[model samples]
Structure formats: C-alpha cells, structure tokens
Target: MSSPGPRSSVSPSGRSWRDRRLDRDGSLGLRLTLAAVAAFLVLVPFALLAVLVVGSWTPLHELDAAVTAALHRFAADHPGWVRVMKAWTHVFSPGPLRVAALAVVVWVWRRGSRRLALWVVTTMAVGGALGALLKLLVGRDRPELLDPVARAAGFSFPSGHALNATLAAGVLLLVFLPFARGRPGGRLLLWTVAVLLVGVTGLSRVALGVHWASDVLGGWLLGGAVVAATAAAFRTWREQAGLPAGRTTVDGVAPELVDPHA
Candidate 1:
C-alpha cells in the first residue's frame, strides 16, 4: 500500500515545520525561580574564592609539611592503603573522563532529552571554565605533598575535579528533581547518588593532597552557583519560547513539544 499523502501528516493550520514543535506557556513563578538561581550561581563562586584566599592562605604553606609527615607515618604503617587511595583519586581525573562526559551529553541531547543533556553540558562547561579562570586569576600553587598521581599543572585555589563533578552532579539532580519531586524513594535515590558523586569528588582532591579543605569547599560553591544559573537561563528560555508547560514524554505525542535546544 502507498504511504499516507503529505496532507495527512501536515498540521491543519499549516504551521511551519519548526513552529509545530514549539511550546507556548510561561509561568511567572518559574521565570522568577530561574532568575534567582542563575544570579546566585553567578556570584557564589567569586565569594567562595575570596573566602578561601583569606582563610587558607597561611595554612596552605603548612599543609604540605603536615601531609608529608602524615604520609611518612602512614607509609610505615599502611602503605597499601595509600596506594589504593591514589588510584581511586586518579580515576576521577578530568582529562579523559571529561571527554567521555562531553560525548554522553551530546548523544543524550540529540537522541533522548535535550533538557537533561543541556543541563549536563552547560554545568560542566561553565563550571569547569570558571574554575580554571579563577585559578588563573589567583595563580596559587598546589601542595608540594607526596608526588601527585595525576599531574594538574595550574594554580590550585578551587579544585577543578571537585568543581566539575559537583556541577555535573548538581545539574543532574535538578533535572531529575522535577520528575521525582513527589516520589520519595526515587527522589532519595537520585539525590543520594548526586550527593555522593559531588562529595566524593571533593574529598578525593583533599585525600590526594592536591587541594586544601577550603579549595574543595570553594569548588563546591562555585559549581553549585553555575548549575543554578544555567537552570535559570534554561527556564527563562523555555518560558520565552512558550513551549508546552510541564514535563514532556519521550515520544512526540504531547499537545506541543518544547525544543530545549532552541
């Protein structure tokens, strides 16, 4: 049998191909929420850095000496554990894993959910770049502790690994939160994983002696701020685009589909 004629598939209003896929709703509350989050995200990192500079400046010089002494003590007692911790921390190095994250984000955005994909990509890109820029501006030094397993040659005020993981995980939480909002079990699982990833990544930097406690804290704050900002921008764009409000399913059967990509 022949396929249905073009008329059968065309929208009766003859809306343009692109127009049919757009949504058209804008909640005042959502716009406000997005704006607040974005503003917070943009400012928090700088504040975090300032705090770190003030609080950790002196302690940083002493940190390496402390770490060296601790390492010597640990080596005499538990050398195997030290090696294991180094390997675990090295696994989180941003070089190769970041490339993988990029690929995953692109693939998910193109094939599955643009909103989720954008969440991942935006958080990582913005947060990682910001962290690097902050490090450059500060131009601090890494601890001269036991030789680093992963060679990150740059100023070490805000830990990049900590920031990257924190942003990525935080955005994932936000994206999933809407759907799981009322479902306590699902929400708990989602948030728990997100927290673990963010927290563990931060701790790993400290465990490896690449960052001071303050740097990790700064990175977390910096990353969270970016996620909030990106989420706000996304919500604003969604509102302005006026796509169908609320969640959309995987299939294109809703009243209208919002192109988050737009």
Candidate 2:
C-alpha cells in the first residue's frame, strides 16, 4: 500500500484544522449577529427619535407639550411629590453616579480585574461624551414651564440625568452580578433595582419640567445602546482569549470575576 501523505494537523482535543476554522467562523458570526440585534433594538429607536426631534414632527411636539404641561400641573398641586422627585434627581445625578462608578473601578482594579475596570471607565466616558455631543448637535430646548419645579442649563434633546442613571445602573448591575450568580432572588432583585432606577430617573426629568417625554426617552435608548455596545465588545475580547462565552444577561460581563484567583 502507498504510504499516506502528510496527515492533517489535529489539536489535542482532536479537532482538525478545518473543524477549528469552521468553529472560529461560527463564533465570529454569532458575535456579529448579536451586535446587529443589539443595534437594531436600541439604536433604531434612538435614531428615529432623533429624526423626529430634528424635524420637529408635529405629533411628537404636541405629545411632548401635553405631557410636560400635565406634569407641571401635577407638580404645582403636589409639593411633596415635587420634593421627592427633586431629591431623587439630585441623588442620582450624573456627578454622583460618575463618582460611584469611579469607586467601583478602583475596587475592581484592586481585585486584579484590570480589564474590567477599564471597561467601566470606558463605558461611562463614552456615554457621557456622546450625550454632551448630541446635546450640542441637536440643540433642542428644554421644556419651559411658567413655574418650573427644577431647572437645568444647556441643550436638552436628551435628558442627561436619565442617560447617566441608565449608564450607572447598567454598569453597577453587570459589575456586581457575578456575586449573585447562584441566587435567583438576588438576580431578580438586581434586575428590579436597575429597571426602577432607569425608569424613575427618566420620569423625574419629565415630571420636574426639565425635559420633554421624548428627551427622556431618547436618553434611555441612547444610554442602553452604549451599555450594550461596550458589553458586546468586551464579550468579543473574552471569546478571542479562548474563554467560554459568558451568559451576560444572567452572569454579567465577566463571570470570571467570581473566581477568587482569576
């Protein structure tokens, strides 16, 4: 019998080169599909809102005006509610949220999760910068109320308070979720808190008469998009490093964080 030609290279796991290539291509395709889906879910809404805001769509403008007027009227009648919203907005403002994120970055870095720390910083910075840039580009005015419950300066197409709150909630949730992995109740609580924070922050902006309904909605969409995009990028990095794909929804951005020695 003729001697066999050079044999195909096989990994220790017994996967041939062609099998490995196919696996890699499939993984990459999955990642791309995920990214596309995320973009569609978040960016599409944000872009549509931006277009409507820019074009001064009559129905949207009418809806914003009606919502603002109704909220302002309610604030006028309920001093206690106004005070509570003011307190909530102040506590969750961008400044305090950024400070909290910085503290987490320090904690994670000290724990030897240097990359995770970097991700926290990058996500916050990018979100903040994008918010500011969009504010300038859109140059939309804040809702003007005869008796404003709260006041904010600068352009207001997207509510900064809502954007920052969403970012902070998402970052904190992902960073701490590894610790809650095995506890269903803990996971449920975390999700509830995150949703509550994002929802109330946006509502406070509209109720306080500093932002239109659309503005707050825009902030939420943009903020969520930022978080999803950065998290996806991080996931891609983990895969390229030969790590198992993380169930980000359940385990957070880096389940490796649960390892005391990781």
Cand. 1 Cα-lDDT: 0.63
In TM-score terms, candidate 1 sits at 0.66
Worst ten in a row by lDDT for model 2: 16-25
Query: What's the lDDT for all of these models?
Result: 0.63, 0.89
Give the alpha carbon lDDT tens digit for every residue of 101-183 in model 2: 99999999988889999999999999999999999999999888777888989999788988999999999999889889889
Which lDDT tens digits does candidate 1 get at residues 1-120? 998766656553675634433423324344555476557757766695566585555664476457545644554466676576666566766665577677757765665576757667
Q: Candidate 1 regions off by >4 Å? A: 1-38, 45-48, 51-77, 146-152, 176-182, 243-262
Give per-model TM-scores: 0.66, 0.88
